[model samples]
Target: MILEQAILNIKPEESIVFEKAFAEAQKIISSMPGFVNLDLLKCIEETDKYLLLVKWESIEDHTIGFRQSEKYNEWKQLLHHFYDPFPVVEHYETVISI
Candidate 1:
């Protein structure tokens, strides 16, 4: 599985609205192909920061399958505006697990 990670820095005081928008946006991503699961974690030290982790079957599943699909526009529309400078997304493969 490929793990997609992004550190989202929401606009000041917009976390609540972002969360609500994400609630709807999550449904869009969850319905896509190769989607395993996702978690949205809020930071304790920085309330405006959030960690988004999504598991996919392959990198293509997210880069091509999802990003290239029309659904991506919906996802962007719902949650993109909440970001300040925008987030950097990265993908990883597990090396070791207990």
Candidate 2:
């Protein structure tokens, strides 16, 4: 499995609205091919910050499959505006797990 991670920093006090938008956006991503699961964690120290983790079967399943799909536009429209500087997304494969 590939792990997709991103640190989302919302614009100031827009977190409440962002969360609501994300709630709608999540449905877009969850329906994509090779999607396993996802989690959105709010930061304790920085209320405007959030951690987004998604599991995919392969990198292309996200980078290519999801990003290239039409649904991505809807997803972008829903959540991308909430970001300030925009988040950097990275993918990783497991090394070892207990």
Candidate 3:
């Protein structure tokens, strides 16, 4: 499995709205091909910060399949504007898991 992670810095005071929007946006991603699952985490110290983790079958499933699909546009519309400076997404493969 491929793990996709992004550190999202939402606009100040917009966390609540962002979370609500994400609830709807999650449906879009969950329906995509190669999607395994996802988790959205909020930071205790920084209320405006969030961590989005998604599991996919392969990198191409995200980079090509999702990003290049029309559904990505919907995803972007629903949640991208909440990001302050935009998030940098990275992918990982598990080296060890217990």
Candidate 4:
């Protein structure tokens, strides 16, 4: 599995709005090929910050398949504007797990 991680810095007081948008966006991504699951996390110290972890069958399924699809545009439209500066996204593979 491939894990895609992003630290989203949302605008002040936009958590509720972003959460709603994320719920909608989740449905879209979940329907895509190779999608395994998604998790949205919030920072206790920073209310405006969130972490998005998405699991995919492979990197290509997310980087190439999802990004190139029309649904990505819709996803961006729903949630991208909430970010002050776009978050940086990174990918990882599991090394060890208990």
The root-mean-square deviation over C-alpha atoms between each candidate and the true structure, in angstroms, is 0.4, 0.5, 0.5, 0.7
What is the C-alpha local distance difference test score of candidate 1?
0.98
Clashes of each: 0, 0, 0, 0
Q: Which 10-residue span in candidate 1 carries the lowest summed lDDT?
A: 79-88
lDDT of 3 by residue, 39-83 (tens): 999999998999999999999999999999999999999999999
* Local accuracy by lDDT, each model: 0.98, 0.96, 0.97, 0.96
Q: After superposition, how far is residue 93 of candidate 4 from its true place, in Å?
A: 0.5
Model 3's TM-score against the true structure = 0.98
State TM-scores per candidate.
0.99, 0.98, 0.98, 0.97
Better of 3 and 4 by lDDT: 3
Worst 10 residues of 4 by lDDT: 80-89
Give residue 76's lDDT in candidate 3 (0 to 100): 93
- Worst lDDT 10-window in candidate 2: 77-86
The residue-by-residue lDDT of candidate 4 on 2-95, one tens digit each, is 9999999999999999999999999999999999999999999999999999999999999999999999999999999999889999999999
Full ranking by TM-score: 1, 2, 3, 4
Candidate 1 residues 47-69, lDDT tens each?
Answer: 99999999999999999999999
- lDDT computed for candidate 4: 0.96
Mark the regions of model 1 whose C-alpha exceeds 4 Å error after superposition: none
